[model samples]
Target: MEIFMETPTAANGGNPGKKKRSWKKLLLWLFLLILLFSLVFHFTSSLLFRKTEAGHLKFITPTVAQFRHEIAVRGDISSSENQDIKCRVRSTGGVMITWVVDEGTEVKEGDTIAVLDNSTLIDSLDAQQIKVAQSEAEVKAAENNLLTAKIAKEEYENGSYKVNLQKLVSAQIKAKEERDRLAEYLQHSKILYEKGFVTQSQLEADIFSLKQAELTLRAAELDIYVLKEYTHNKQTNNYESDIKTADANLSSKKSVHLQNETKLKDIQQQIEYCTVKSPSDGKVLYVNETNRFGSSEFLVCQGAMVRERQTFLRLPNSNKLQVTADIHEGKISYVKVGQSVQVHTDATGDKIIQGTVIKVDENPQPTNHWMGNVKEYRVTIRLENPEGVLPGMTAETKILVEESQDEKLMIPTHSVFEHGGKYYCIEKKPDGTLTPITVELGHSNDKMVIVTSGGLTEKTQLVAAAFENRELISLPELAAGETSSPTIRPKNEEISGDFNGENSNSSSPQAGMKPDGEMGSDGPKFGAGEMGQNTGMPGEIPAGMNGMRPGGPRPGGLRPGGMRPGGPRPEMDKMEQNGEMSAGMGENGFPPGMDGMTPDGPKPGMGMRPGRPRP
Candidate 1:
């Protein structure tokens, strides 16, 4: 096979146009490389720096040194005591509203607000007055008639005595005459029968005449007695009946008089109310049945039909404006008398007004359809300065119930950790170690917390959060048991024991054995003048105990000892005086009287009774 050599074309090499095209392609590739590098850098940085931890992270600070209580502003408004005013009476009469005062007019006590057309009422009142007059006259006439009837009854009772006496006297005289005639006739008839001058029939007739005379006399006497009894009983009863009739007439007249008086008073009051006077010193608010007044005029216009007792116009005291804010039932507890408040009127950048809660209504306001589904209490706040504020102005208010100062020490609530049912703060050690410290806390306003105890002084540095992606060390595991040492590391160079700076490895001294073989003294045994350098017994007795020996058993039987007579045994004593023995030769080798001695009693040579023999 034969190979042919190819020549370089203008587009591939030395030609200017071909060189520019090649350079353009190279520039484009360089740009693409740069874009790719930027993309890789952005992706890697985002992945590395993203916040992926679940717990909250915050800068550690003493709760007492940061955060301030925020203050709130309150608002006030005015509302009508009478929400709705309706016509109280139905009438089509021409209601002429009399203008007692014009708009923007200031009225005083008893000033007239307006007068409705009172012609109808006046006419009715006049008619009532005439009827009252007529009733009064009739009552007077009835009273006079009752008086006349009482006089006539008294006269009739007095005349009854005379008529009864005359009847009784006449009946007695007639009865006596008839009895005498009957006796005379009976004697004559007997004489005639003895002489035989008369016939038997005549004698019988005479006897019959005597018997009739007797009967007549008896009848006359009975008539007199009956007349006297009837006069005494029936006449007295008639007098009593007449007196009762007089009383009934008097009562009837009195009742009529009372009714007339009551009607008169009522009519007078209705006439006075017709004038439509202002109840307070205020500007006339408006006229009913017409809107021509500028919210300050009270007038009764012609052809306006007004009813009885209708509110023709309103008079509101605009100078002293009050606000009634509806506090929701849930927040009513926070709203009390004398709480500080600020009021803002509308959204109009107006100056905020200050006020105090004056009164809180005990009962909540009745809910209505207009009010959303919420219970509210009407709280009245009296504004101190109500110069420019008008009634019915919309306002927004915020009540400030609580507040605090700034720069108060505050810590993030979550930074505090709990373990073993105790609160602790995680503090970082110089060697990068972490440990927990118990702390007492104080007032916390939800967002921040306060540490009240546990040696947490102001500005002490603490761990705000646990190390990222690092596991927390458990305190229980580190401590091992309840008697284990504390984790505090002292800064002093002299402290050279366990974490609690206690000698954990040293063996306890044997019973009755001091560091020195013999009892050197009642104090620490050291070379002469070496007290400061030696780690002597922490609470050792003074030297030269004289008759007593060091590390010896107490005079009291097997009693643990301390500086105070009855105090707890020194912790160091347990380690230093272990297995010590008693020196006295009593029972159980205890000192004499030791069996009766209490644990708190002084030992034999404990300076009691200075001259006594030492144990």
Candidate 2:
């Protein structure tokens, strides 16, 4: 019975083996469906959700604006030449406020702005004035003293002193003579006393007389010495005193004069400071005075005490407006004087004002580390029509530093890439493929570049910008030993032989020829017959043909004919012979020694056997 059950063929739904097989099939189908969906999603994403590595999607647009040109506009205003105002003193006691006139007030030259409190100055000046007066008086006194001293010296030398000196000298001589006489008398008295020629009393009396005489002479000599000493002391003291007095007086006078002059200058400066005037004819924009210990503008005030040299208000010249824009250092090389500029004020909408580049900064401004990694140069632009512009206005300026005109063949700068110092363009072929075409480039502004040569024409289509994350198709690989269908020929290249033949059939010779004939041999025939041929008849003269016979024709000689074996050989013969001619042969065998044939040379017709010359 178990065998017959034959595994009862496990009830279709209840058999675990059969059920497991079905479940496995279901799972496989689900996996396949999921895989298909995933593949579709990946393809769609690649096509739709494409972006550059920097998370940007790029696309190509027609470069309609091949060239950018601009014009600069600027405001007109006047500047003050007298920018600096000077005063005697700059800083003194605790930030003094010396208002001349109000900041924006108008005044003429020499007008005052403000005045310092000159109370102290005035008092000092008065004191100096008094001192000057006193010094003047002292100087006069000194002059009088000098005069008195001179008179005293002259009087002493010529009158009193001279007389006294003479008297003293005379007394000295008299005293000397008296002393000699006394000495002789004493010698004789001594002799008389020793010989006892008289009594003792008489000898003593004689000695006394000699002694008295000697004492008198000594007294006169002592008086002379005392008088001389007195006179010398007086003269020296008087001269020294006079010199001292004069020096003091002169010094005092000079000091007083200098002080007075300095005081006058101070007074004048104070008066000048009292009046205020406008430095320039500009409208005052701001007058702020909020001392908050910040920047300069914040520290200014209106009613607050404003010191000298402190900026109290700002007056911007709205008439003459200019924009100071910073250009990147990398692109500064293209900036030059006279370039056109388009300035976009932030306040204004998309409307742009025109301007011209007035100046380019020669040096770069200082940079701070906090700023992004970039270097910039300051460029000044003068607006061409600055109607409603103001100072300190922020603007974005686009400078057109270069330009090209009139339907020039231009290509994308990046499409014409360079490698190994050679420029190339990825030219599109008729088979929806690309070919690497070497190109010669010319002047380029910033984006589109000019193609000067290398078989590039206006109809030639090139890949400008490429899709991101897409592989580049190499021309050599795509060609695979097959030539590209579309051939790019430059505008100046000649048409193919097939096209030329077709053109020739459709056009007549006269129509195809230019007014001056085609270039090269197709040009107008200059000489007779074909080029490089000698086409002369039997003595038939050729017109404008040199080294040929002048007669109309000869019996059996060369002549000009409609057709000859070779073209005219004038040029060849002239070149070979180096321009030399026969000495004596003419149209009629005329001799070289003719009337008109001078020593120098013969004139053309004068030396010829006249027969209408050549044709």
Candidate 3:
């Protein structure tokens, strides 16, 4: 840049005074030019470097506005009272879904929403039937045994006992008759002997005969008493024990029968559970299909095995509308329960929904690992007149965290800058020079910021942008004290599918059933209702034989009750200690690191040796 100056030649040659005046005038113009050049150069350098401010700076005056401080968040609409349809059937290995209602279908209460393949359950039921029959047979056998025992006891007590008593009575009668006959014979012999014709030897012989008969009768009487006291009592005791044993067996069989019946009933109930129905009337929301690790699978469909109690569907109560939004960690503190909010969504075509913040979750939502450790709180908003909204519609919300009612001086959002914990504005002075003015800031919006302090007025012209020689110290200062994340605008649900992508989000059973043949790698590894390692012969129990539990009652054999317990061995203390080192062990100790062996047996609990306790 060059300056134009007319020569003072005429005045210079005329007089010394005039020349001096002319030179003074020239020096004054030169000083002014130098100052202007300096200012221009500074601004030029700033422009070249694309620094804070340059010659292109514009100025504006502050205006008064209603200042409302709000935090903006994005989230989805959902039913406040969602009724989840969960998988109710329980199995050690899961159950395969046969058919399910199409996602997002409207249905009434008690609608048959889904059906599961119950072939396995039916097979189990058949096995249960067999078990019940076997148990019943065992119960019947035990009952028969008990009845036989009772009958035997009765017969022995009455018929056999009476017969034995009658036989004994007959023997006693015979013995008595013999004794009487012998006595009579003896009397006759005595009378004969007493007479002259009778002999004394004969009478003596008759008396001895009579004594023998009496002793024989006494023996018979003793036998009867012994039979009644010992044999009959012993028989009765035996019958009682037999009956007790039979009764116990019957009770055990009855318990088994009850268990079998219960198992049958359970299988029946599970079969019923196979047919899933919606409990309430609403639109059906299929749960997101997930893998075993709980990661969402794009391929969830029929034949997917849902675990017990896994959510399959959601019946949203659309009449009661609410939204769940994710508020960033930095701004979550501004949100609290019972604050007013404004919601916007594309579905409503910019129609704003009035609402209130019903909940500000203290805990953070599960975030993608790539999102760093930053927590995003789940803020709940209850909307007024949200009649047509549905679940999964993304909502743009602004929570009114703070407000200042009085008219406050505000300016465009870009005009303010901060430095060293202070806000500043470049005020254009009347003298045509700009200087920095410190200002206290308050509420702000997307387009304007409120100025609370500093001597700024309504008519003061402030630099619209920071210029050369005036740069903010921090990144936050340049953005008018707002921390905004870089984003793509008008985010919709389709674009947010990858949200929380870095985090594995497993879906519920019914969320993403795509078609008949689709499934995850870990979901229903079996295809087309084919079971893995569970296919078995009909009427055969799936897990065990004769309804015996698997993995116990026998471990060495593949089937239950197929193996016996291992035999006993000598107690550790009773084992004889070998003097020599064990086979494959060095001569020192059994472990080949010995200090105790001296051509003698190993000490107790020492290094292991043959016939010795392990060290």
Candidate 4:
């Protein structure tokens, strides 16, 4: 019994040792399996991450942020209301300024502002004075002639006409008396003859004397009639005509004299106008113009000819200030009347002046052809407090177009690209795989764009720029029946074909797909003149196809221009020989058939193949 108990003790002790060893072995195997699994998992994850990041050098995590939509433009400060002092001279060819007040000089009303050349006015005044004197002499002569005509008329009517009538009446009375005496004498002689005391000759003489007296009486009566009727009328008519002619001459002379006097007054007034006077009290500001080459277009110096009504100086109100800026046509839609602006002037350094947009011009500023076709609209902003700000200072304006009241998801403008007329961005998956996801966009500025929707979150990571990594990315497949490609033609362009499915008869299913299809980095492919199949990603035009020339249909039902998608056609040789083909050369500077053989010898790496001859 004692021997058996000792043996049992030994067996129990061995069992404990073996159990400890077995437990240790199982733990070690578990550790080794865990280590191996961990290594495999790490290697897989690293490979996936590297593959996703192979083409991308930049990445961004979407975040909720605020971006201000604003437009910045540089402009000049000016006064809202300006009292322009214009040139008011009316001289021909404009008047030349002999003297002018210096710019920025403050003056009171009625002060002499400028003086013009008055020499011409002085000469005109002298000539006008001579004309006035001559007209005055003519007027005096007309007055004397009028008086003499009136006196002559009165004298002829009262003195000459009355005296002639009286003389005729007296002659008639004497002739009547003589006729009566002779009649009486004849009667006495007849009585004496009856008594036979007188001889017959004496009676005859008495009768003849009576007859002569009667004839004398008739002549006197006729003279009286002629003097009273015909002679008086003729004399009155002559006097009246003389009076009318003299009156008309006097009126004409007076009119001429008045005209000369008016001219003389005008000349004197112009002489006074030669000196310009200030209409109001203000500081003078010259209205000079600067040309494109930084030279003054209109200088307000002495001896410069000023045009009529041209604004040569201005009197601006310093209290009312404003800024004028030009907004480009692309961003002008954001600007409106009454919008707020922040102005920073060079003179007021670091100080921001608050202003309001008071005016927006309807028309664009005129631009030169060499300046490019960029239309800019003028915007006027009135300063609220114009203290310490002067006119003509340079200023930069920041116009606040829009601002976000709530934080929203946003990304850089370059992170999004257009595909199939929809915007997309490369999204990084949790497993480190990249995929293109559609995104809805809202208002954008120069730096950032607002993401309206697309299931994006704050933790979403996107490629910083999509176009820069488009080659390494796998683009989305096109929808059913969707064909998108560009057309290519030769330099002469006699034939045409559309890579989008028009006039295409290629048997290959992948022709004209991606832009750089088949013609990879090794240059263009010349595959027995057969229509090539594109091996590049779909939906994007590649750089290789950009240099393709047009060709007509050929054997095996090639597309309209025999020219395939991958490269040019063999018919190009015949076209080149006939001078009908003038396509642009590739980087090697020679066509396929004309390679290597040039007037200057063989080109680098472009020597003719061993079996081919130069065309």
396 Cα displacement, candidate 4 (Å): 3.2
Q: Rank the candidates by lDDT, best first.
A: 4, 3, 1, 2
The RMSD of every model to the true structure, in order and in angstroms, is: 27.3, 29.0, 27.8, 20.1
What C-alpha lDDT, on a 0 to 100 scale, does residue 259 get in candidate 2?
A: 67
Q: Name the weakest run of 10 consecutive residues (lDDT summed) in model 2.
A: 478-487
Single out the weakest 10-residue window by summed lDDT for candidate 1: 478-487
Off by over 4 Å in 1: 1-104, 116-153, 181-213, 235-239, 242-246, 278-321, 326-337, 343-353, 359-379, 385-615
| TM-scores of all predicted structures | 0.41, 0.40, 0.62, 0.58
Model 3, stretches more than 4 Å misplaced?
1-63, 289-300, 363-368, 412-440, 453-615
**Top-TM-score structure, candidate number:** 3
Clashes of 4: 9
lDDT of 2 by residue, 144-232 (tens): 76677777767776778768778878877877777777778667877877897766787777778777777877777777777678755
**Candidate 2 — what's its lDDT?**
0.51
Candidate 1 has what TM-score?
Answer: 0.41
Clashes of 3: 9
Q: What's the true lDDT of residue 63 in model 2?
A: 40
- Clashes (backbone N, CA, C under 3 Å), per candidate, total 22, 43, 9, 9
Pairs that collide in candidate 4 are: 489-550, 490-550, 515-541, 515-542, 516-542, 551-561, 552-561, 552-562, 553-560
